[model samples]
Target: MKFYTFAKSVAYSILKPLYRIEAIGTENFPKEGGVLLCSNHINNFDPPVVGIMIPRTVYFMAKEELFAVPILGDIIRRCNAFPVKRGMSDRDALRKGLSVLKDGHILGIFPEGTRSKTGELGKGLAGVGFFALRSNAQVVPCAVIGPYKAFRKLKVVYGKPMQMDELRKAKASPEEVTDLIMAEIQKLITEYR
Candidate 1:
């Protein structure tokens, strides 16, 4: 098996038993092609948890600083994570993300830009919307509930792909697209609750 698949297997073996991870609407995930998996971030484990539930290998953006860590950096890099400089445009990171989509790979993103300390959904950054529109990839909204505590059930719900035809045709502004995507994510969160 590939390193990521093997690592995910190991992680699932450990995390599933402790958190009772339950995934719903997994069928909503596209079986192939480029896809953007957008979700809310609650903690450091969010990316791996979401990646583990999805059937495809997910290439996610991590903070540039994380890539500087000793052994942990090597692990995340091997898992297909690229670094993004937080709090700035970081065009290089954006280009790398687009390249992943162009190569027909899944790109996982947390639209909120950072973890919500209160576990509440927050405003999405415009970068995600820009990526979705530029790449012309379908976006799957995901909601991750409860993995906040060990030994507690963690729920992940994947919503249907957001329809972008109308918006794309209308040449919607970045802000407008971001708002719509955020609203869809909010709906998924509500559904989980």
Candidate 2:
């Protein structure tokens, strides 16, 4: 927790000046309990930026490849990141993610599954939806908008926690839930961008 706070402060000190970072709609974020922050992926920086901006310790499922890098892997590991295999269902990763949320910590997911090369929001994958339902965590749609040029304004918008009672009653499929979450992210991007 100390390391996370230190890293967040350091990241903010550097990034705020260079990116002109702006975090909006943060009031929509809940102060307690488990939260699933689903956002559109734009770049490698998206995870850290979102992690630092939010007022909670966000444990992310990083790509397995990132864990192979010597220094980066260690750094991210200390930052509460664990590895996840892309393009296939990795049960171990899912279990780890669930454990984090079950312990009442926030989990951050880039629902698009990978970074957008063109800075546009993409279709979300069902993994996030699965987590939302299984963990019963508050699912909050988030948007990170940036071209990431130095001194350029960048925004991270957190939308209200989704009402999942209806979806839960309807017994929604993971894919269907993901679609709604992605649409909400798109809405945030449209409204805030």
Candidate 3:
């Protein structure tokens, strides 16, 4: 926790200037309490870019293979990263992430389930809606604009938190809820693109 606290501060300090960062709709974030930050993934660096950019410590669900790289894995683990089995439900990963939110910590998930290689936005997976309904934690939609191009800047745009009350009142079926979350994720990402 101490390491993340320090790293987060240093990271934001450097990145805010380096990347010309701007966080839109930041007020959507509840100043305190757990939050589920769902973002569109486009680059391998997206996690750290968002991680170091956000003011809070965001526990990211990274692939298990990343944790296999000896010392780098140890550093990532210390920075509050957990491994998810690639190309699967990764039930254990989801459970652990939910557990973090239950403890009032921010958790980051890429609902699209993979990176955007085509440079076109894709739909979200069902896991996002499932966890939101179960946790009742606020969801903060986010987007990343541009790539980590050589000598170019990238942007991380934050969207307003989805209204949990509205979601509850909608009395959406499972499919409806999933569709709704995906719609929001898409909206958040489109502006960035």
Candidate 4:
């Protein structure tokens, strides 16, 4: 009946067996309220994997190019993913994200905007951190351990919520918050990997 239910069903039906999945700490997710899902970006399908795996609707900021593909774009739109420019801040994207949190849904973000070609975790972009601060939402630090494929048994581990106050200090720049989130996420991913 809900949009998320349809999206989840379709995504699971289509993707679950497409890649082997090993997920943990999903219980760490709160039963209600606005929450930020901060995760490392390694594979192209990481967003969908994380989004569909959760029972709650998790809206993510999709890189604009993903929308350029016809069929994939349609699916993404149906899943409630909004477009975001990689290098520049897209105000419209931010507004959509802000509204999603205001609506009390999960906001999924790959702090590193791009997929890691080298498979090396890079620094995070500030969007997730700043958004959490603005929304006063709980930040759920998650990691998807490598190689989204059947044989690998891809791992997804979600740790406990990170303190929002970590980003609330007077001198905290967006970049610092970004690094903190990335480091925390990277640490989890490293261990999982």
Candidate that would win on TM-score? 2
Give the worst 10-residue stretch by lDDT in candidate 3.
146-155
lDDT of 1 by residue, 80-183 (tens): 99999999999999999999988889999998989998999999999998888888688898988985688888988899988777888889877788888889
Instruction: Give Cα-based local distance difference scores for all models.
Output: 0.89, 0.89, 0.77, 0.81
* Residue-level lDDT tens digits of model 4 in 21-40: 76788888888988889887
| Top-down lDDT ranking | 2, 1, 4, 3
Lowest-scoring 10 consecutive residues by lDDT in candidate 2? 1-10
Instruction: Give lDDT: candidate 2, residue 109.
Output: 92
Q: Quick one: RMSD of model 3?
A: 2.3
Expressed as tens digits, the lDDT of each residue in 14-91 for candidate 2 is 887888989998999989988999989987888888888877889998999999999988888888899999999999
Candidates' TM-scores?
0.97, 0.97, 0.86, 0.91
Q: Give residue 85's error in model 2 in angstroms.
A: 0.7
| Clashes within 3 Å, all models in order | 0, 0, 0, 0
Candidate number with greatest lDDT: 2
Candidate 1 residues lying further than 4 Å off, grouped into runs, are none
Expressed as tens digits, the lDDT of each residue in 71-161 for candidate 3 is 9798789889999887778889889988988888888888877898886668777777767776768888778777566436677777787
Off by over 4 Å in 4: 1-3, 169-171
Candidate 4 C-alpha error for residue 111, in Å: 1.0
For model 2, the superposed segments whose C-alpha errors exceed 4 Å read: none
Model 2 residue 170 CA deviation (Å) reads 1.2
